[model samples]
Target: MVSTPLPPADEKAVWVRSMFDRIAPRYDRFNDLLSAGVHRRWRARTIDALAPTGGETFLDLCAGTMDLAVAISERAPGARVAAADFSIRMLASGREKAAATPGPVHPVAADALALPFPDAAFDGCTIGFGLRNLADYSQGLAEMQRVLAPGGRLVVLEFTTPPGKVFRALYHGYFHHVLPRAGALVSHDSAAARYLPESVKAFPDVRSLARLLREAGFDRVRYRYLTGGIAALHHGVRP
Candidate 1:
């Protein structure tokens, strides 16, 4: 299969939105196959790190399918969740689940780099498997920090390069080879399938991502690898 080229710098956001729009119908299904349903555990870890409280506002940025947002609402029954993402189709795919949540989970079509919400608007924010798609990771982190209230936490659940060399090699082989083919077959969008591994390869590893979180003006930044380092959950507090 021909590899899908990463989007040009000037068009990254637009390209990402379009790509996700095409795959929104199968996004959740493909995610289950790719991670073997392990993404749910990773998202559970994100909620644990955030330890959200009742009556607080949360922003599930890049909240494709509203999985994390719905979970957060379930956890904090009195909280409000803004399921924000640039791809409207992606958001639409999960509207029913979001609506069924005991707490409110409002779908908001917005870009990650430039959020429409006011500063310090959220008590917590979470992004699951979505940050690396951004045109600028730094700007994304900064924007996350900007919308969070002081002392509010940001939890990021993302694919990361593993630390152990042997495991890393095996992980890469599957990610670069097996995942793309399976993704293509299931999603019927080969370019989007190929883009997954390519994007994860270009994304920062656990430590580097932690550093970026710190540099983004977040305090108490820390990360924990999950499932043999196939993915990671990083959390930080806005000061």
Candidate 2:
């Protein structure tokens, strides 16, 4: 199979949306298999950072399959979670799960860089394994900040390079080599699968992303590496 480079910045969002739509059918399952179900633990940690209480409104931006939204709903039971994503088919794939969640999970078609809601719309916000896919990380972070209420917490969970050299080398070997092939086999879209590692490679590191959150006007920024630094969970608050 031929390896395709990631789309240029001007065309990224459109290409990403279409790619996700094409892979929506196998996205969840492939994730489960590839990460050996550890992605769930990472997401659980993200929710821990968000610390949702009952009766709050939350936005799960770039929520491809509403995984975080449903998890938050299940955790708080009285929260209303909006699962916003630009890819309609990706959101559609999670409809059943959202419907069955304890709290209401509303799926909305929204661009991360241009969210449709008014300012201060949510009590908390989260983006899990999704923020890196945004065409403009700064703009996306700004939009997330804009919709959050004063003191609203923002939690971001994303793939990152490990700090340990040996672990990093081994992880990169599998991540860049094995995982893409497996993802392509499962999703039946080699380019989309290849985009996964390329996207992660192109994204900022954990500390760099924390600095970005601060630069985007979030206060009290903090981050912690997860699962041997394979991923990171970042927390910040809107002042």
Candidate 3:
């Protein structure tokens, strides 16, 4: 499979936000179709990694549509889950979804790099499928570490390039070609789907990501690759 080059730095975030806004209506549906419903399981695993206790203040960064936030609320009923996103449209959709759920999630519009919160404000944080879009992913990771209290856990779930030679070839083909086409057909935004593959290719992988987390002042940094390395859940502590 031919690798598609990453988009330039200046245009990447703008393109990603625009694409997400365009696909916001069908976002959940597209995710279900794209990942064959496995994203739900991945989210469950991510929430499990965080292991939120009741009554803790949890922050879900880049909480696109609040999937992770809702999952956290369900898993830890007494926990207060706050969802933050830079895109107003995405936050609006997430708020609407949260309104229907049993547990209430506070939705806030905020940037990932410069989170609007006091230091060490949250007990735990989770970000799913949203880190790749940040202009400075390292800075975003640092902000996540900053907002967490001492010993607070940070969980990040993201797509990654598969490792096996044959499977990697097949995955790349599907990611770059088939996914874009199907996503365009379903969401009516080809650029958004195209951006997905590009962003994954550009984002740091598990090993490098763990290093970045440590650099951002996190300790006990570790990651588990899921689905044969096509995705990963990275964890760290704010020590």
CA-lDDT, candidates in order: 0.92, 0.92, 0.87
How many clashing residue pairs are found in candidate 1? 0
* RMSD for each of the candidates: 1.0, 1.0, 1.7
TM-score of each: 0.97, 0.98, 0.95
lDDT agreement of model 3 with the native: 0.87
Where is model 1 more than 4 Å wrong at Cα?
Answer: none
Candidate 1 Cα lDDT to native: 0.92
Instruction: State the local distance difference test value for candidate 2.
Output: 0.92
By summed lDDT, the worst window of 10 consecutive residues in model 2 runs over 1-10
Between candidates 1 and 3, the lDDT winner: 1
Order the numbered candidates by TM-score, best leading: 2, 1, 3
RMSD of 1: 1.0
Error of 3 at 162 (Å): 1.4
Pairs of residues at least 3 apart in sequence or in different chains that clash in candidate 2: none
